[model samples]
Target: MVTAAFPYRLYLVIAAEACAGRDLLAVAEAAVRGGVDLVQLREKQVDEPTFLARAERLAERLSCYSVPLLINDNLRVARRVGAAGLHVGNHDLPPTQVRAQWPGVGLLGYSLEYTAQLHTPEAEAADYLGISPVFRTPTKTDTVTEWGLAGVRAIRAATPKPLVAIGNIHAGNAGPVLQAGADCLAVVSAICQAPDPERAAAVLRNQIDLYC
Candidate 1:
């Protein structure tokens, strides 16, 4: 059975482009050192071999700390590399399909941006929900739905499932996201593209803690 792996409030979504020429392992290590609990590798552009290699490296990096490494949009790679979980967007494989096909791979997360999409049977098949575009975020150009704080609050009240608020989230605005009932906050550029990913993560972690 799928279970929740998102116990930590500060979620880091890291992509190679966001690393700014730094090694992905280095970036992940720094972020973890600064208190990032869960990580999702969003490297959808690479070939299969490269993707598996990176996922393996990241999984090895986080093993000692016990931080789960989630592979984005590639359940095959996730299982091959022994990734802790999988995260899929709205356009990708629906959560129900993933669950039915895999049986018990790991924790499955689906993107939920609209209140209309809340608490659906597909959502129930997964372990957690990602409430994306919580604000206007350029970090993800493909995102069409921009769910503001009001939407986050609405989804929080509407769904019994665990909520992960993501998109353009930073240290300054994390409080309100948490106040709106987000169980965790997923950040991309806020921490991944910062000058010091470790320091950025620390500040963001403090912001999340302050809200609690």
Candidate 2:
């Protein structure tokens, strides 16, 4: 039987600039209180030490709730801080190599930027596939093709791995995103930029639960 890696329904991707102009730790804590399943720290503008420091602090808080912390493109930091997992894009590190390098990092997530990757050995070994750019968004400048709802449906039909639909996902259209067959809905600006992080998280979680 295949084991699920990303078992959470609400995936929150937070960046320092995106956290409602507030402390990311505070925003994440409130988001957890509102029911975030997992959290990924995707800082685009920070040095190694700064990133490591932030990860350590966030790991401490998220651990209390038993929520997994995933580092974006940084396996060293994740392991250094005793993070639960790491999220890697296709361009970062090959999943096969990562698996060989760190066999113990339990939750391995692979970003699916194109349809051709669905059947690769990497996808087969991955615990979850992040279907990104489900809609056009400003959060990521290096985005792949806009997956749209149709793309989600196509990828869902093509893969057995747990799907984490990302990019521009919000409470407004979260139901459809889930219905399109994503096991989890990952958002950046939606909750991170909300006026009230807890409420934003709650609303998104509600949508996920409702659709399920």
Candidate 3:
């Protein structure tokens, strides 16, 4: 929970698979240089050893910028590396379990699509909520109904936790999401797949500030 106290800045998380063998540090550095508030290491297909190693490196690199580094799914690696937080999906580990394992590390995030999930006790325990697939997104392996700005607005109105609009949110549509009340934006291809990630991040940050 490195930046837990200052969560207003746009949370830019880059989800890169370890299998792709991409240079995560370079990508992360560019993002941070462009005012990204947070970075999450999301490597789903990799083995434990490889995932831990990469997460460790990312955590170290982010330390310089005081950028919060989060881990997806693995609480052990998160706890070991002192990650800023952890992001858990519907099928992944529960937020309560993560809190129990690492009580000192209070920042834990959860994924939500349907508004009903936000009413649950577990959702209340999480630090933030990542409401996704505002448009059709290939990144979501699960079935995602397009929860447009209206849906995102509903989530923002319903939850006290800060909202992070994810999946298909980019420079073009980011304004509406923030207007809908999103505190942050989580993007993958919008930044990672961009020709110039640094500039892409700045554009997204500008949009975020505009709407904020």
Candidate 4:
């Protein structure tokens, strides 16, 4: 069995969505300035060449800030760009497989919503868990699970890994998520779509601190 690795660690991560129209690299830079500790690059429609280019640029930009840049669903790009990690879903390769392929590389996070999966042995090997749909969100239209504050707590109690609450999490709900035992909030539309991304990120950081 794949044993647990990364210790539980609290962190603020910025999730880049496919639906967001803005430039992700620029937004990532702004988020780092606003104290974001991690950034996930997730693009569904973009081709390999285009995705690689963008990921490379983003990696370069993030290098100076010491932020962990993780590619969602693409281990190749994560390897190529020298990213800090990769976040994969249930359908993707398991964290154990990822660790086998990239032996000494960085983290490998899994997306977990259900309590059962969160407590599974494979989940213990994950560097972190992205517990999603905290509130009603248009971003995850196909995903129906809405793991509210109660769900967040349930998942946290099941695993020692740091929990990152995503989907519909914004400035307003950030405090409650932390209070519910989430180590951080993974924001997508709230920061990527905001008129002032830096300001929005600042507000999220402030709220997390205030509630802590």
Candidate 5:
């Protein structure tokens, strides 16, 4: 069970490719300046060495802002970089194993692809739960469920763990997602691919503050 409320209000899930040719570190730095409280480095298609290098760079950059960086499904890189946490999906490493392997990890997140996952031990072990693909989006094509607004409410009702709502989330839809019971908003293209990442992040941050 979560011992404290999840501290982050705006979570950014970023990958180098998603930045639309912009410098990943620069984009992340700007986003943090605009009020991003948490960040996750997701380098899915890269090799371990490349992923490790990127994580190392990102960890260093985020350290300056005091924003915790969560490495997505890469335990070796996470451990090597001394990341603030690790986030795993159902097909990735199990949260129970992650806990056993990295007992000192500060934050642990698990993606909820199905409501039934909430009843499992992994969900119980996570520091917070990610309600993925709250709406269908091209970024995540393999997800099993599109946990729309109703799904967010259902998950909130079932678990007290902090919920980070992801997928197709932007300023326009952020308020309703929060009202539906999400504790934080996680975004990708909305900020990464924007013409000005700082302004984009600030806009989303405002939505979170205004609605959540």
Candidate 6:
């Protein structure tokens, strides 16, 4: 069970390609400056070495601000970089196995692709639950459930773990998601591809403060 209150308000899920040609580190730094509290490095197309290098650099940079970095489905990189945590989906390493493998892991997140997953051991083992694709988006095509506003409300009623709502979330829609019971907002293009990541992040952060 999660022992403390969920502290993050605006979460950033970033990838090198998502930055729209800007330097990944620069974009991340700008986002943090604008109020992104938590970050996750999700590199699906990159090789292990590339992923590791990115994670290492990100871990080093984020450490300066005391912000936590969570690696998405990359246990080795996460462990090697001494990241604050790991976020895994249904196909990746299970949360129970991750706990057994890395007992000292400070935070563990599990993505709920289906509502049924909320009742599984994985959900029980997670420090937070990612309500993925709260709306369908090009970034995540493999996910099955859309988990629209109603879905978010239903999941919120069912689980007490902090909900991190992701997929196509931007400042315009952030307020309703938080009102629907999400504890945090996770975004990809909203910040990564924005004309000004800092301003984008700040806008989203303001929504969180205003709504939640």
lDDT tens per residue, model 6, 1-212: 11356788899999999999999999999999999999999999999999999999999999999999999998999999999999999899999999999999988999999888988899999999999999999989989999999999999999889999998999889989888989999999999999999999999988788876
- Candidate 4: which pairs clash? none
Residue-wise lDDT of candidate 3 within 102-142, one digit each (tens)?
Answer: 78765788888677888787797788888867777877768
How many clashing residue pairs appear in each of the predictions shown?
Answer: 0, 0, 0, 0, 0, 0
Q: After superposition, how far is residue 165 of candidate 6 from its true place, in Å?
A: 0.2
Which 10-residue span in candidate 6 carries the lowest summed lDDT? 1-10
In TM-score terms, candidate 5 sits at 0.97
* Candidate 4 structure quality by residue, lDDT tens digits, 1-212: 01244332224344445326666777778777875767888776678888898889888888888777888888899999998889887778888788888886588788875677866766876877888678878776655578888898787677677777788888887778888888777877777787877787788888877865
TM-score of 1: 0.94
lDDT of 1 by residue, 88-162 (tens): 888888888888777876678889755677757778887889988888787787777888888887887787788
Off by over 4 Å in 5: 1-4
Model 2, range 1-212, lDDT digits (tens) per residue?
11354558888898788875799999999999998979999876999999999999999999999999999988889889988888888778778877888899878898888899998999877888998788889887686689999999999888777888888899899988888888888888888888999999999988888876
Cα error, residue 75 of model 6, in Å, equals 0.8
**Whole-model lDDT, candidate 5?**
0.93
lDDT of 5 by residue, 1-212 (tens): 11246878899999999999999999999999998999999999899999999999999999998899999999889999999999999899999999999999889999999888999999999999999989999988879999999999999999888999999999999999999999999999999999999999999999888875
Give all candidates' CA lDDT scores.
0.84, 0.86, 0.78, 0.75, 0.93, 0.92
Better of 1 and 6 by TM-score: 6
Query: Alpha-carbon error at 107 in model 3, in Å?
Result: 1.2
**Model 5 residue 22 lDDT?**
94
Estimate the overall C-alpha local distance difference test score of candidate 4: 0.75
Instruction: Write down the TM-score of every candidate.
Output: 0.94, 0.95, 0.92, 0.88, 0.97, 0.97
16 in model 2: Cα distance from truth in Å? 1.2
Model 1 C-alpha lDDT versus the unseen true structure: 0.84
Candidate 6, residue 127: lDDT: 94
